[model samples]
Structure formats: C-alpha cells, structure tokens
Target chain A: MSEPILSIRHMVKRFGGLVAVNDVSLDINPGEVVALLGDNGAGKSTLIKCVSGVHLPDEGEIRFEGRPVSFPKPIDARSAGIETIYQDLALANNLDVPANIFLGREAKNRYLGGLVKTLNDKWMLGQAEQSLAALDIRFPSLTQPIESLSGGQRQAVAIARAIYWKARLMIMDEPTNNLGVPEQQKVLELIRRLRDQGVPVILITHTMPDVFAVADRIIVMHRGRKVTEKRTGETNASELVQYMVGALDDTRTSA
Target chain B: MTDSKAMAGFDEPALSAGKRAILLISRLWAWVFLALMIVFFVVAVGVFSSATFLSVRNSQNILVAIVPVLLLGLGQTFVIIAAGIDLSVGWVMSLASVLSAHAIRAAFNAGVPLFLSVVLGFVAGVGGAALVGLVNGLIIAKLKVPAFIVTLGTSFIVRGMSLLFSENTTVIGLPEGIRDYGNESLFYWVRGEGGGFYILDKPEVSGELLRSMDRILAWPVVITAVVVLVCLFLLKRTQFGRHTYAIGGNMQAALRTGIPVDRHIIKLYMLSASTAGVAGVLSTLRFTAGSAVIGDPLLLSSIAAVIIGGVSLFGGAGSIIGTVIGALIIAVLTTGLVMLNVPAFWQFIVVGAVVIIAVLIDQSRDLILGRRGRGT
Candidate 1:
C-alpha cells in the first residue's frame, strides 16, 4: 500500500544488437524481498545492473524514493543509498574487515588544522565490530584480511558494509552462488534481516528454494522479457519453472 | 542461533600457540634474516680477517651503501604493492642525476647563491624524473599498456635521454659547498689539541686542531632516514596507502568502491619516480659529480631488496620496514663479502642465490598461511 522504494518503468538495455534487458519494469517496496528469477543470460542481471548503475538503460527511467534518478557511476547510486553487492563480493581481500567495511568512505583523524589526515582506524574498527555484531555476525579477528575469512564471513562483511552505509535499497547478485550450504543459509538470513530493517532488497538468484524461503515477491524473466510476477505464496516452484522456461507467460499476447 | 553455530563451524579454529608463533616469525622473517646475516658476517670477519665487521664505522659503511637501493626499493615497494612495476626507475634516477648536476653547475657559473643553486638542481632533477613517471602512468593507466612494457620502453628512452643530456660524460665542476654539504656530519667526536675529547657541531678538518674525528651521522644518512620516515608515515597511516593496497588486492573491487584507480596509479608512479630522483641527487652529492650510468647496476639490486623484504611480487601486501631490512641484507652481504677478501664475482652469485632463497621462503609462507586460510 505504501510507495515503493524503487520504481523501474519500461527499462531497456542493449549490448550492440542484443537486447539484454527488454522493456522490463519492476517496483520494490520497503521491507520486502523481491527475487528476480531467471535462467543464465535471462536479463535478470542486466535489469538490476540498470538500477545499480553498472549499465545505463537505453530506454525507460528509474525512480528512487519517488524522485527520477540517473546514476552515472556505481558510486552515485551508492551515495543515493542504493548498494549493490556483486557476485564477486566486491571486497579487497588483502585488507582487514574494517577496511573493507569502509572501503571508499573512510573515517579520518586530521591534525595540523586538517593539513595531515590519517585513517581513524580505531574508530572504523569499533564501528565495524558494532555493525557486524548488530547482525549477529562474529569474526575471530577483525584485523585478519578478508581472504582469510570463509565465504560466508565475506558475505556478512559485504552486507554489513551496506548496512553501515545506511543503504535504503540492497541489490545482491548471486550472493549464494559459490557459498556452501551453511553459508547460503547465513546469507539468506542476512537478506531477511535487511528486509526487517526496512531496506528493500532485489535479489538476483537462480536458486528456487532460496526464492521460496525468503522472497515475498517473485518476478520471473525469460529471454529478456518478464514472464510472470507472483506472490511467493501464490506460486509453487513447478509453476515458477514453467514461467522461467517460457512455457507460461502472463505478459505474452496470443498472436 | 543455529545459523550462528554453523558460521562458527565454517571459521578455522583459533590458531594454536605454536602456529601463531610460526606466523609471527614468518611475518618478521626479513628482519630475522637481516639479523642472522649480520651475526654471520661479524663472526666470519672476526675469524677470517683482522677487521671487526660489527664496528660503528662498518655499520655506517653498510648504511651508506644501502641508500640508493633503499630509495629505489622504497618506491618499488609502493608499485609492487599496487601490483605494478617501474623498470624505468633506475634510468629515471640517472636522468635526474645528469639534469641536477648540469643545473647546479650552470647555476653556480651564473653566480647564483649556493643554497638557491642546490635547490634549483633538486627541482630540475625531481621534476624531470617526475615528468617521466607521469608519462609512464598516463600510458599505463589510460592507454592500458602493461606497466612492465611501458616502464621497459621508458627505461630505454630515459637511458638515452640521460646520456644525451649529459653528453655521454659525468657532469662535474660542482661548487665546493655542495661537497661539504654532502659530507658534513651532524655530530663530531674530535680528539682536540687540548688532549681532551670534544663533541663539535662541525668537524675541525685542520690537522693541527684535530687528531682524529668520528663522524656520528653523515648528511646522506640523515636525509635517507628522513625520507624513510616520511614514506613510512605515508604508506601506513594515510588513506592513499589503504587505497594502494585495495587497488592491488582487487582492482575491480577498488573500482566498484568508486576509488580513483587511474589517478591513484598515476600518483603512485610519480611517487616512485620522485624517490628515484632523490636517490639520483644524493648520488651526485656523494660523488660531487653525476654520471648518466650511475644507477645502471642498482636496478636489479633495488628489486632484489624489495622481493627479499617479503613484498609479494603479485602485489597488495608489503611493508616499508621489510624493504629496509631487505636493503640491509643486500648491503651487508656485499660489504661482508669484501671484508672477507672474497672474489668480487662471488658477490653476484651469492646475492642471486639469496634472492632465490628469499622468494622460496615467501612462497612457502604463503602456502602455509593460504592452506590455513581455506579452513582445510
């Protein structure tokens, strides 16, 4: 009933002659997880890329918090309170957890009337500890580089980064792809926590059970086109598979 | 609650005390290597020769020998940590040396003040090398040329430019004050004419007034120390340093975080060239002349020091202190070999072997840490 946090209308993104995302439109409301389901190369990634500022849409508009917005770079979208955690995790593996948490925007202590500035590492480490703890995530050592952490812990760090930055909308691309079973469950739990915090999440995933378990709405895309949109309770995995494979289409018109 | 336990299960157990000790030792392996080398040299020199290698004079000699390589390694540390290399650094230093020598000579001939002429020479030297670094950065960052290729090509070009600029000869005829400034000591312990030891600010060079004087710290060493301290601060305490590691660690991640990757790369190369410039000027000051080929043999030594210091060639992890130890290792090996009357050719063979050993140790440490990191 309330206004959607992000609205995409008639979005189109093309790579050369290939239309990767074709006239796809979706709305994400606050406190809800929208599972963007699709097969490999099925425009789901491209659609989210448009909103996340990875690719500019060739057609259509994106509105965030009721204002028409265009992000020229990923940083712009981030500054606008939309954080995208790429499938690769977007972490500097050589750096510690706190450094990853405050990658670009680091806290600093300035001396000599701001002439000399050093990273306020103590402050950042404390804040990172609090944020991770808030999400019930614990690390044996916060100073260990991200590469030493397990896959699930890296995901927690990424999610904590989004939360620390106060992102209103979280976009995760295949967050559970390379994770183990337990790690996958941890990530899904984190998604639920994001939703509970009133941050809308657009989850691009291929896992059916993940969609069923956490997503409130499911939008299935096939061949760069949206096939169906359904409430999680309304659609079973079999029905979603039919829509995903283009066997069922709610938007297609019979010729 | 169950998920939290699952997460805990995924983490590798806290390192055992023995393993933690190994980790600490491995992390400080470069320093340990340096200390071990000094002990070996002291014992070897004492047993095989009449001189003591551990004396203050020999230590000063080692530190002085470390200056050029350490300066170059300091810059290489940044580049290597950023997953880049600057082959042009040696030649860039040569070019700066020639330029500064010429500028100083010309300024002195033009009746410029001694202090201003020295400053002018420094500006000319650092500015010239920095320009080369800028070009190197732009081509590598913007045109996407590989850093190794770009620096190699620039190295050849700068080598030719230095020879051309200096007319294929060492520039000489520097003012007398320049040599004095270069050799001056911060403190001098003098056996004075009154049969008493006195600490003087300036060494009384006259034979009548001074029996023997021990120079506590020379200007070159002081200058090098100041440069080291500043670089230490820059690399450890600043955002620029954090971004340098991030860029090297995962450049894509750095870009996604909105870091100015290209700009930072450009600055990094410039910083590297600037250090080389400093080394060049110091060499000119030490010798009171600048030769186009002075930095020629130092290229490999500087890189050897960097790798020996535990800086991963793959980038994203290294420290300035490690590079300093690495430099000391090289300097000590060279000086100790000479003290033992070893054939000069053996120095190269031994250093080359040490480099291989250092890299092997580094790789093994990574394997150990990496295996543990995977929670296996």
Candidate 2:
C-alpha cells in the first residue's frame, strides 16, 4: 500500500489533571474515509482538535504529507491544506453565501499596482455558483445571508469552501448531526464525492450506520484509548458496540 | 417516505411580490421616515407658525447642524457594525479640538505661516484622537475586555485630559483666516443691485453680503459631503468593510478563517476616533475656538442617529446612507421643535421617542418577515 497521508505517534493531550487523550496513535491514508467513533468524553474531539490546531498536543508528532507539522492556530493548519468543518459549521451567518465561501481568503481587484484593493464580489459569486453546481447543490438565492439558508444548504457551503481552497485533508466533526434525513443523505454523498476526488476525509461521528456506509476503516476509542480497529467488512454493528462500550479491546494485554 | 417527499421539494420558494415590497420598504424605512418628518414639519410650521420650514436658508441650517452629528455617526457606524462601541468618541473629539487649537495658536505665535499653522492644527487634532483610539483598541482587543467598559473608562480619561489640557477654559485666538475658511461658501448667488444675478466664489461674509445672499453652500457642507462619499465607498467597496461585517457577524468564524481579528479591531477603533477628530477640527473652525465641552452632549445624539438609521445595535448589518438619514431625521426634528416654540427640554424627549420608534419599526420588520424571509 502507499504511504499514509497523516500519521499520529503516541498522541497525548491533557486538560489540567485529566488526560483527555492518552497515548493514542493512528494513521490515515489517501483517498479513504476514516470514521473515528467514541462515546461521550472519549477524547475523540480532543484528538482531532490537536490536528486542526484548536489545541496543541502535550506529547506527539503529527506528520502531514510525510513531513512533521505543528499548527500554531487554525489558520496555520488551513494554510497547510487542512480544513476542518467544526460542529457549529464555522460560517459567518450574517454574510451571504459567496461572502462565506471566501470569508478569510477573499478575492480582490487591485488598483495602483496593488496599493488599493477591493473585494472581487462578482468573481467570488461566479466561482461560488460553479462550485455549488459541481456539488449538485442548489440555493434559491446566493445573496441571502447564511442564517436564512437551511441547515443542509449551510453544510453544502462549508464543504464548498474547503473544496474551493483545495484542502488536502478534510476533517468533518459530525457533519450530519442535527440535519434532516435527506440532508444527512446529501452530506454522506458529499463525503463520498470528496473521497472519490482523492481528498482524504476524517469523519468523526457517533452514528454506526454512517460509519458502515462511508468509512473504509473504523477506529473506536474508549476511555481515552484506542480499543479496536477494524475494516468495514470485518466488523458488525453489535461487535463494534462492544468495542465502543469497552467490552472488547485489541490493545489490552489480556485480550 | 413523507420526509423524502418533502426533502425533494425543499428548495426555497421565490419571494412573492407582496413580500418583496415589504422587504424593500423595510430596507428603506429610515429614508422614508426622514421624508415623512420633513413633510410633516413643513405642513405644521406653515399652518401654525409664520415661518416656512422648507426654505433654502432653513435647509442650509439643517445641513450645517448635521455636520458634527453625522461625522460622529459615521465612525460609530463602523464600530457598531463590528460589534463594538467607542463611548470615548465624544471626549476624543473634545480632546482633538483642544489639541488642534493649541497647536495652531502656538504655531502662529511662533511666526509659522498661517496656512502651515492650520495644517499643523489638523495633524495635532486627528493624531491625538487616533492615539486615544489606539489605546482603546489595545485594551479591548489584546486584553479581551468588553468594549463598553473600555470605551466608557476611556471617555472619562479623555474628558478629564481635555479639561486639564485646556485648563478648564476654552482655547481661543485662532487666526481670522481659519474662521473665514470655515464660513466661505463654494458658490454665492447674490441678487444684483439691478435685479440681475451675480454668482461669486469665496465672497466675504459681511452683513451686506448676508442680506443679499440668495443661495449659499458653505465649505463645511461641501467638506462633509466629500467625507460622506468617501466613507460610503470605504464601507461598501473595500475588503476592510467586508471583514468588519464578518467579525461582527461571527468573530469565531472570522478567527478560524484566518482573519487577524485583533488587528482589525484596533484599526476599527482608530477609524472611529479619527472621524471624531475630523468633527473636532470642524467644530473649532466654525467657532474660531475650542472648548472641552463641545462634544459632551453630541455623543448620545450621534448614537441615536445610528440606531435611528436602522443599523442594528446587534451589529454586522448597517449602512452609511442609513446613518446619514438618521442624522437628518434628528436634526430636522430638533429644528422643527425649536421653530414651534417648544421648550428646549422637549428636544430630548422627542428624540428619545424617535429612537424607540425606529427600533420598534426594525423589530416589527423582522417579525413580519419571519426567519426564512429576512433581507440583507
């Protein structure tokens, strides 16, 4: 097999007296969907937060594209081609669709040889329309603010933003949560599309059906430790539940 | 199955004609209200009083009155849209006024050229206010202190500094040229002695000239217009304006998207203070003196204009044009009240009522539109 795209070695994170993520390691390869499953307080979010630069790891090295990397902030991680779709969507809800698509990285028209620059609204709007069209998403009006859009449309905008910036690795934290049944299906389709386009996705979710549907490999965490890792075909829902509940453990000495 | 059926038709429907009309009206409500107020005053003053409220002279008076309030509102527009407030703006203006007066006087007394002294005054005034803005920005942005507390504290500090600097007295003795520049009209159309028309430029302001001055647009009015146009362009066409809305709309989203949030906040405060500085210099020029108390009462009026203009106090959604109409509304209301021989205190009560009315209209607009149909 080809080399892994992202490799975490003995990752450790602490919140004062609590070891939120304890000495866990994992590898993700290109063009694959990896579902990170965990119960409440299982440190799933904490681990991803470290890679996305929301939190710095106390101990561990993150290698992206075969080079050791450290992200001082979310922007640094994004600049290095890591885009994270946070649970809250990380969108400026008061802004219009095109504006959100190019929020921090706005396109500009320069005058006086770049001394004066204005937002290239027309260009951004056209590009946003094309990208959404590429994703087979439709909006009644692109000029309306994000708050006016449906939850599914907002999710589509976020995914389009990552794609527009050419993100190498997409991290989605519960993208289908709080969405309607159809919206959930739409988001899953987008994830499969991302995988098809050779952009690896790390999907953190609690939905067992979602894991089986889209994830090629499932990694379960229990009590801040990796309890088991299995291919989609090798694991059943009931067996995976045992690992999630700590009834089974591959890393345990007795087991 | 029902959910899937509904999902297939989930695309938002187009706004109906009636809904579109409501959206347009709500968006332009400030301008509509300003027009209505003007017409009401014109009719009331004509019916109940001997004076006309719609004359060119009265209109000029209203425009002149709008200068300071509009300037203050202009800066406040940016701050409010960025989900911040700078209470220090009023005293910042006073401080700028005092500093400029001192700078101009000192330069003139030292035999500096009159023109250069005036320029120095401009520098000192705007620069001083900008420094206060810098301090305000640093404390609020870096320390993560609430804007209300920081600006309120700075307002007191600035007010005290102004009084201390001016020695609790007005700074006077500016060169006569400054006042002349302030009063000069861009075009003066005087009725000629023989009933012909004579248009003069930079005509001297005298009792005789004033008597025959059929029409006049003063330099201050023109200057204010230029400033307004520039601000409108800055807030609409530039990247800075877009980022201001983003920061206010969702600061966390802005940070995650890689915006330099703190630096932008500092720049916003500075922009606000510098506009206050501009108002100060204009005030000093108009009166040929600077008092630490000039901007004391204007702060609330400026904020009132912004709110009345329909810029949401919640931030991220407002316009320069709205604030302009808001200022006009207040000025017209005050001028009309005075014309009707209302008590001086009535102006405050009336303005407060108008502010409440404006907010209520905004809220009603939102309710009427509902969540799915709100406009930008």
Q: Who wins the DockQ comparison?
A: 1
Model 2 docking tier (incorrect/acceptable/medium/high): acceptable
lDDT values of the candidates? 0.87, 0.87
The DockQ figures for the candidates are 0.45, 0.45
DockQ, cand. 1: 0.45
lDDT of 1 by residue, B234-270 (tens): 8999999999999888898888888899999999999
Estimate the TM-score of every prediction. 0.95, 0.94
Candidate 2 chain A: worst-modelled 10 consecutive residues by lDDT = A144-153
Provide chain B TM-scores across all predictions: 0.92, 0.92
- The best candidate by TM-score is 1
